[model samples]
Target chain A: MQIVVDLNRCQGYAQCAFLAPQVFELHGEEALMFTPAVPDDQRERVHRAAAACPVQAIVVGERAGPGVR
Target chain B: MQPDTLFQRITDYANRADPYPLYAELRENGVTRQDDGSYLVGTYHEIAALLHDPRISSDYRSRTHPDEAMIRRNERPPSFIGLDDPEHDRLRRIAMRPFGPPHSPGRIDELHGDITRIAEELIDAFRGADRIDIVDEFAYPLPVTVICRLLGVPHEDVPRIRAWTNAIIDSFDFTPGADQEKRQQAGLDARDAMARYLGELAGGRRGHPSEDMLSALVNDAGPEGRLTDVELMATATLLLIAGHETTVNLITNGVLTLLRHPDAHKRLRDEPGLMPRAVEELLRYEPPVHMLPQRTPLADIEVAGVTVPKGAPLILMLASGNRDPLRFDDPDRFDPEREDNQHFGFGSGIHNCFGAPLARLETQIALGALLPYLDDFHLLDDPPPYRRSPLLRGPRHLLIARG
Candidate 1:
């Protein structure tokens, strides 16, 4: 699955960091530095991180799972 | 008549054990327009939509104060959780730095061990007592202590903090015929007192730096970094109340619900790994903050074919949303393993419970420790008396057997 974060909309709330720190890294000034895609092994952690996003900014896609539609 | 204006039934003390029946009745009508012109979104889908909608404001004052009528005549500003964008964004960011990431990453998650120790200590105390009140003994102290330690609140001052927080939160009860003026004034006084106390703490930190949240706010980098005195008080007041009351309910409710449903507790005891999932279910089935009432519509918005007029008062029932059948299978039933369960135990969206990680860790270790130690236990009384608040629901006292 893949993840996407629109930095423009991101206020650096760091809620994403609270969820999945490994995937979402916040630097000084709360700027988000992150991994856009997760390998099959890290899918679980990625999904958790996505759920944790308060803004729902992190969008995740399935590699070969249920369709978004 | 549908009793449209009669919110009294919603507050019926008889419905305390299971207010779901009344909530279900409200949903049958799709929406209940109150006498005060506010709309209570009891339906599952509607609350979910409102919570997700950016236009819905979490600021309670915005919803309740039409003319910005203070919940109290003498009150400072509220925490960012009760605020809107730009300003809410700014305060919440600065506040988040010391406790959470970009500045202090993994602070909450790292407290797992300390929380576990705290839980064990509480459990150790319960070893000799055959019957105990979970609220007073375990649930109450654990969260309050953690918040105190994390925020650098003095242990001596915790009782005062608790009293102030309780006074403010007490005013949030939606009980019909409550003295509006008295409630508002008390809520205000409590908040004001909390701010003053926290401010003093912050001032002390200025001369002497320490390893605490108050000190961090005092010793910020630049103009943008520091919080004004008012801002610090408001923010600290938020943490204090949010710290003291919320998790106590979570812990108490978890134990009560589990004891109520022995099958679940037995399963959890058999498999400790399920503690986390069980906590999630507890959040859904019986959340700490049941229905957060401060969501005001930013503009006219259509939710489930019902148009919520712009600037109209909106009540986002988080509890109702969690039980929406559309969201979960047999939503009423508490199933820890129920996957795809994105419940709003904590406030969802931007203002989701900031202390969720702390709350979760505390409950997990708490329930975990109690599950085993409570070899054979049962509720002291069925339908235990509950606190007088619908927004924050939990038993007034949950006496359970140990031996």
Candidate 2:
């Protein structure tokens, strides 16, 4: 399983960046600076980073899901 | 005598501001039992263990649940936190669906803007005031409004519900010789009244869908289907109470703590990016939900060789765990940059805080926004007087002067 963040809804709390910076990246404005996807080897980091998102905008799986909006 | 016991004192008002010492005393051992037959567990490891134990029920309907007479007089089944599985599992699932898939990504990301907007509005109210009581002025309205908006509760009813919410929380105190009956009844009246109020509010959304949790619960067709009338009321009660009460304390504690610890306050102001970790540290150092609902030991439970007999009460001090020197270096130090901080601010295991993500976001935003503003402020008291309930710990009023 991998992680995917919908940039459209991301407000840049950077919680993902804080929890698993190895996989998730936070820009200066707090939005995703890089891709949220993680390799299978980094699934643990991806899962934790996903869990860390307060808005629950991070999706974890082989595929990305629809946006809340 | 265990110093953790709050049996002494001419007034129980001292409980609100800081229950940390009592927690420290309780942390000195496995568990201490009060004369009233209630127990207190302040050790983080022990609390974590009990929180994870299935036998330790959070539900009042459980065999070892708190007596109805012990709870507020007229409230229906207690909050979802005070509930056992099956029902707890059912309601928690529905309550959480719209929020997120438990540990999934942040779906509430869109609300960040709205939350910021709300925070700004509340701050607007604080602009000209010379002295601000954190409770009445800032912390209180922030979370209360957020919950109201989240649950779709009408803002007009907030005052009434807020009163009921206070009454319900007041009833949970375990202070010796305290009139539990009066507080409990007030809590009961608050619950029924709030339930009736929320029930009416939710009624209109039955056929009509709204973008709120209540609407989601009302229309939920998940594995458990929609919430029952009773369950719906209970869920609303939980959201309104849990949504604000715990968070308000957390936000207030964060501000008051900063005002007292000017250095930490300065560091946060200089480095606004650290607000996230600061929020975590604040949670550990001064958590909102101080003690959890009572837990009854099943059969015989042994912790580090001491056996807690069946039916014995156990209280888990999560905040104390955050300060445990065994787990954290200088556990009491309010360091926002403190690494490896796996504090139990939101409890842990299955019943961990469902709204933790939202709560964290709110605090980070509120604190991050307010840090610069509070930099010039000073605490009027070394330790401001606390609220009455040990369960919901925080200052009743924190006076800060920017001048």
Candidate 3:
């Protein structure tokens, strides 16, 4: 799975960072860093983090399983 | 037929108890133009779109009138919430440093225990009283005490905090012909008082570091990311006000709503696991912030096919949008087991509420503490008296009697 955060759209809510700390990291005041690829274990959290973003800035790709769309 | 004077009616103090019907009327008309030539966007999708639109500006400088520029210019430095991006984004990031992730990843999460203890302490006092004013005795104090501890402000100074907060909030009315100068003066005076008070506390924390946010803000960081004295004061004052004011309403409104809907109240008590989503539902059904003031369009913006001309003032009716039937099934009814409950309660886009995590934690803990008491308690006043500020809507006094 892949994670994409629209940085311009991000308001630094940091909610995503809290929900999926493994995938997302916040630097100083102006920067937000996160891993692009989501591991199998981190996928659930990444999705929750995306849903938790107040601005809806986090976008995640399709699920890992065979049932995925 | 057009919706005549509906905006005014919605804002009128008389309708403070309930404005959902008027909001429904507004949605029916799509994006609406009020008598003042400004617009009120009431639908869920339209409000959400405008909130994310770059053409939409939160800065008061984009306003057309002469008095607006003068009033906003003369005031103390604008809070990040009132400014557009680059500046807004920068200040918000700086402000978030001590409160949220990367630097202090566990800050808000750590407060969960403190919040629960605080809620429990306040709720414990209700055991002896024949009747309790929930606003004064419980709901108001819980968040105020929590914010005071977080900001490193002395808990003894809450009276002054209340006075200054009231003055600052009173000055924010955007109704066409409200008394601007007196309110502005009051707001400035309050700002000065709070700045001087918090500055002294922050100044002491400069050399000796502490665990609180004020200490981190004052002692830590390079000159580049550091907030200037004025900016610090403005940011601190904004946090002080923004931190507690709305949360008080959310908790109080949550209790009131739950009491009104007995089944939801009982359900919450039985299934404690539902607290998080229940709190979100409370936010949607009776949100603390009803009307967000003054978003100016940098260019002519089309909302729901209605052309909002450049420089026109648009009021984003957040509470109205939360109840749009087009967005939710049976929007008027309160349901704790709501799905896809992406609400405008904390707002959307860049200016979305910075203190939301803490607010949610505070509300979740607060309602948990109050739910048991409410099983046997009832509201003294069915539609209790409301605070004067329509923008920050809640009961001024929620009297509860033991049954």
Best-first order by DockQ: 1, 3, 2
Compare candidates 1 and 3 on TM-score and give the better one: 3
Local distance difference test scores for all models:
0.75, 0.70, 0.82
DockQ top scorer:
1
Candidate 3 lDDT, tens digit per residue, B125-207? 87767799999998889999999999898999999999999887777654445566778778778879998888888988999
Which is the winner by lDDT between candidate 1 and candidate 2? Answer: 1
Can you tell me which runs of candidate 1 are displaced by over 4 Å? A1-16, A19-24, A27-69, B1-6, B60-75, B178-180
**If you superpose only chain B onto the true chain B, what TM-score does each candidate give?**
0.93, 0.91, 0.95
Off by over 4 Å in 3: A1-13, A19-69, B1-4, B66-74, B174-181, B222-224
Question: Of the true interface contacts, what fraction does each candidate have?
Answer: 0.39, 0.02, 0.24
Range of the 10 consecutive residues with the lowest summed lDDT in candidate 1 chain B: B67-76
* DockQ, prediction 2: 0.07
The true-versus-predicted C-alpha distance at residue A20 of model 2, in Å, is: 11
